[model samples]
Target: MKRTQARFDVVGQLGALRRYARSLTRDSSDAEDLVQDALLRACENRSSFEAGREVRPWLLSILHNVFVDKTRRSKSESLRIKGLAEMSPKQLDAPQDHSVRLAQIRAAFMKLPEEQRTALHLVTIEGLSYQEAADTLAIPVGTLMSRISRGREALRSFEQGRDQTSLKLVGGRDVS
Candidate 1:
C-alpha cells in the first residue's frame, strides 16, 4: 500500500543518509549506528511520512536528530572518559605502581580464551564500537558482547583470587 511505498522511498535514501550521518558523526561506526537508528525511526513512524515528499531530506533530518540525541546523552560521560584518555601520556611519564599491576593484568588477560581476548581487546583497548569490533572479528554483535562480558568476568575472578597461587600458613599446614 502507500505505507509500503513510503518505506521503500525511505530505504532508497540510505546512501545519502549515511553520508550525512558520517559528516555529522565523524566516525564510521557511529555514523552506521546513527543511520540505523534513523531508519528504525523512519520505519516506525512512516505513517507520518507525507506522500509526494522527497525522502532524502527527511531521512537526513532523522539522522541528524539521532546524532544530536546521542551527543546529548553522552556529553557528560564522554567528557570524563576523554579527560582520562588525555591524562594517559602524563601519567605514563611517571614511574608508579603500573609496572607490577600492568604485568599482572596482562598475564590475567592472556589467560582468557582467544575469542574473548580478541573481542575485549578490540572493543576496549582498540576503542572500537561493538558493531565495528563485531565486524572486525566476523562475529555477531551479541557474540562479541558475550565474549567481552565473559572476559571481564574472568579478569575479575583473577583479581579477586590474586593469582590463587599464594600459600598461607594455617594450623601448621600450607593452605592455598
Candidate 2:
C-alpha cells in the first residue's frame, strides 16, 4: 500500500509531464511515449530522492536526458545504416513524375545557392518571421531580407517558365 501511495505521488504530475514533453518533441505520440519512459525511470530511481525536494522538475530533467540519449542512439544507428554501400543504379532509374509543377518548383529551389534556399525554406515553408528566421539561422536581418528577395525572384522565374510551357502545350495565346 505504501508503494502504491508513492506511485500516486510520483504520477500526479503526469499532465505537466506531458505538456513539457510535447513542447520538446512537438508530436503527440512521441510526447506520450517520452512521458511514459520518464515515469518509468522516475519510478526506478525513486530511492535517489533527497527527501524534501519537489520531484516534478527532477523527473523532467531525467526525461530530457532520456530523450537526448535516445535521439543520439537513433542518429548513430542511421549513420551506420547509411554507411553500407547500397549504391545500385537500379534505385536511381525508378520512373517518377518529372513534370509535376510542384516537383519543378522544388527542383528550381534546389538550384538556388544554399543561403537563399535556407532563408526561403525557413520563412516560407517553416513560416518563421524574418527576424525569427534570421536569429535561428544566425544571420543578420538585412542578409535574411536579401536572401528572401532573391529566393522569391527565382521562384517567380521558375513559375513563369512553367506557365509558358503550359501555354505552349494548349496554344500560345496569352489570355490576358
lDDT by residue for model 1 (76-128), tens: 78999999898777534445577878888898888776888899999889999
lDDT of each: 0.80, 0.78
Q: After TM-score superposition, what is the CA distance of residue 38 in candidate 1 from its true location, in Å?
A: 0.8
Clashing pairs in 1: none
TM-scores vs. true structure, each candidate: 0.42, 0.45
lDDT per residue (tens digit) for residues 29-75 in model 2: 99999988888888798778665567777888888988998899999
Give residue 140's error in model 2 in angstroms: 92
Using lDDT, give the best candidate's number.
1
TM-score of 1: 0.42
- Quantify how close model 2 is to the true structure by its C-alpha RMSD in Å: 20.5
lDDT of 2: 0.78
